[model samples]
Target: MKRPNGEKNISSTITLYADDGREFKQTFTIPLKANTPPPKPGYAVAKTTGTPAYYVLCITVPDMDKTAGEGFA
Candidate 1:
């Protein structure tokens, strides 16, 4: 999931599962280095602090977009 800072696009596929044991796959694209904001259901960059710094991918889920909700991973 590593890309150059000057890269212009990010694409990836994600899999999700339901409580009933059903699975789904979705492909998404996010534009980079654009004047306007990226589209919804994109991702944000985060950093971790410690001996070695690492980047984290914080994805945005449209269905889970709420002000108050419990988080689970």
Candidate 2:
């Protein structure tokens, strides 16, 4: 999530099921850096490489029309 017209990489996919029907899949790659300054009770970003990596959920809407709330306060 980089502004100034650039940067934004985020890919994700998680599915797991078991109960007579088995299924498992996991993949994630999150790298959004715009100097990392967008956190107001919300923040996330992680991408380490396989073997053991986590923290994929993210939310960084710097302006997005005031985080989609419209009348931002």
Candidate 3:
């Protein structure tokens, strides 16, 4: 899905789908803070400057495929 680009900050969820028709739901918390690069490039990298939480859930399916452009397995 296409996202809106503007000066206003917005927080949304991003879902990553697998080729097996399984999807992983993740809620993203975006911070409306200033963007700054660290002294070192690889030191820190984030969509925005804030704390982000991540949770992983297990999905049991028969087959799993990780091919690009392929809809499902």
Give the top-scoring candidate (TM-score).
Answer: 1
Judge candidate 1 against the unseen true structure and give its global Cα lDDT, from 0 to 1.
0.64
Of 2 and 3, the candidate ahead on TM-score is: 3
lDDT of each: 0.64, 0.56, 0.49
Q: Using Cα atoms with residue i matched to residue i, what is each candidate's TM-score against the true structure?
A: 0.31, 0.21, 0.24
- lDDT ranking, high to low: 1, 2, 3
lDDT (Cα, tens digit) per residue for candidate 3, span 1-73:
5533443444555667889988777655656632432232222332544467544444444334445475762
If the candidates were sorted by their TM-score against the true structure, best first, what order would they fall in?
1, 3, 2
Candidate 2 is scored at a TM of 0.21
Which lDDT value does model 1 have at 39? Answer: 45
Candidate 2: where is the Cα deviation over 4 Å? Answer: 1-6, 24-37, 40-73
lDDT of 1 by residue, 1-73 (tens): 8754445444445567889988766644544353444346878999999769999999986655445545642
Winner on lDDT between 2 and 3 is 2
Q: What stretches of model 3 exceed 4 Å from their correct place? A: 1-7, 28-73
Give all candidate RMSDs, comma-separated: 12.2, 14.8, 20.8
User: What C-alpha lDDT, on a 0 to 100 scale, does residue 22 get in candidate 3?
Assistant: 88
Q: How many backbone clashes does candidate 1 have?
A: 0
